[model samples]
Target: LHCGTGKVSYVGGNSKSPALFISLLKRLKATYRRAKTITLIVDNYIIHKSRETERWLKENPKFRVIYQPVYSPRVNHVERLWQALHDTITRNHQCRS
Candidate 1:
């Protein structure tokens, strides 16, 4: 999500993996082609620290990832957005899959 413009860029898959995370980064890079640097505020998910991810970051100098302090969800705005989404859409629904 873009903190300045509130624009969100996302990718969905069956699971979160280093490849998936790199895919998201590639999308962001394509989305902001002229940006000198794209800053991402992320949680300390294992994928974010995976060796593959680290190598990818080294290759992609334009992307920067800043991990939020552990256990501090309130510092991440995306968490709040997700909480609201769950509350409104999935907290108590009759959609039985």
Candidate 2:
């Protein structure tokens, strides 16, 4: 999510992997091409710190990742948004997909 414009950039996949996370970062970089830097607030998910991701980050110096406390979801606004999305759209729904 963009802090200034409230615009969200997201992509879904079967599972979380360093490749997937890197793809998301690429998408974000493309989305905000004009920005000098992109800072991501992320949890300590293994993929975020994986070798592949670290390699990519090393090549892309403009991107920064800040890890929040391991168990503190309240400090992340995106977590709250995700919770609301689950409550409204996914919880007890009958999609069966």
Candidate 3:
């Protein structure tokens, strides 16, 4: 997740899910284990707020996860980056679904 100053980026071989995200959070926790809190502003993705994800959050009191409004892409800076990436790499690409 991207913050005002710091960021935690990961590339995974598997698909995105609550388990992978929770693992990333565990890494963030280890990085700043002593920190009082780590607030993550995330998009309105299903996995982001799944029951498993909520359970993970409950177990780790130091982390707070907030979801952005549905359909409000303007608030998410990464959306712009993703759009650019699509324009650059996937605009005319064709692959198996």
Best by lDDT: 2
User: Candidate 2 on 1-97: residue-level lDDT in tens?
Assistant: 8888988788777778998999999999888899898999998989999999999999999998899875676787688888898999879996643
For 13-83, candidate 1 gives per-residue lDDT tens digits of 77799999989988999999999999988889898889999999999999888998655666876888878
At residue 94, what lDDT does model 1 achieve?
A: 61
Candidate 2: stretches off by over 4 Å: 93-97
lDDT of 3 by residue, 1-97 (tens): 4565546466453578888887888888888788899888777788788899889889999997778875566787767766887899779996454
TM-score for each predicted model, relative to the true structure: 0.84, 0.87, 0.73
Q: Per-residue lDDT for 81 in model 2?
A: 84
On lDDT, the stronger of 1 and 2 is 2
lDDT of each: 0.86, 0.87, 0.77
Error of 1 at 95 (Å): 9.4
RMSD of 2: 1.8
Candidate 3: residue 11 lDDT (0-100):
43
Relative to the unseen true structure, what is the C-alpha lDDT of residue 28 in candidate 3, on a scale of 0 to 100? 82
lDDT of 2 at 48: 91
The C-alpha stretches of model 1 lying farther than 4 A from their native spots are 90-97
Residue 90 displacement in candidate 2 (angstroms): 2.4
Candidate maximizing TM-score = 2
